[model samples]
Target: MIWEVFRQEKEGEYHTHCGNVHAPDREMAKQFAAIQHGRRKPTNNMWVVPKEEVGEVDGEKYSFGGTTDKSYRWATGYNVTADDASEVVESSDEQEDAERRRSEVV
Candidate 1:
């Protein structure tokens, strides 16, 4: 069986697909993933799943984003004073960056 591996570089970060391994069972797949992908890398977490269980749909079969200009729902649309809390500040910064990037793409 083939197993897909995903790795999280740090805490509170997203897990990205790393690589795959061929194993007989889930337990062995986990062990192989830990050694093959997580041994030298600065990985905080890892996930190994059977490749057959993963599914994907082509863009022709799915219309992902809606056809609405929903700029009002974004944080950049409002002019609120900044908060002193670190987490709130981080979130605001991320949202602002995303909005900026989206505007550039559009």
Candidate 2:
């Protein structure tokens, strides 16, 4: 059986897929993952999951971002006042331009 390994470098960081280990059971897989993946890096935590247990969702199967106007999440969507800093206004303008170009491409 094959087991997937994910390693987290720090306490608050995300665990990323590192490598795979060939083991007969979960406990042996964990041990093999520690010896193979953990020893090379500053691993704060590690997870060993069976390859058959992992699930995946692809873009062809589902749309990632919903078909809704979510402009409120962008800087350009906010109302700017005169009291706002010039840098803030500049950033909003740049974001607006970028958003426009991105929309055109999409």
lDDT of each: 0.92, 0.95
| Model 2 ranges with Cα > 4 A deviation | 66-106
Screening candidate 2 with a backbone cut-off below 3 angstroms (N, C-alpha, C), the clashing residue pairs are none
Clashes of each: 0, 0
lDDT by residue (tens digit), candidate 1, 1-106: 9999999999999999999999999899999999999987899999898998888988899888788888899977776664545688899899999999999999
In model 1, where do residues sit more than 4 Å from their true spots?
66-106
lDDT of 1 at 20: 99
- TM-score, each model? 0.60, 0.61
Q: lDDT tens string, model 2, 1-106?
A: 9999999999999999999999999999999999999999999999999999999999998889888999999989989877777888889999999999999999
Model 2, residue 4: C-alpha shift (Å):
0.3
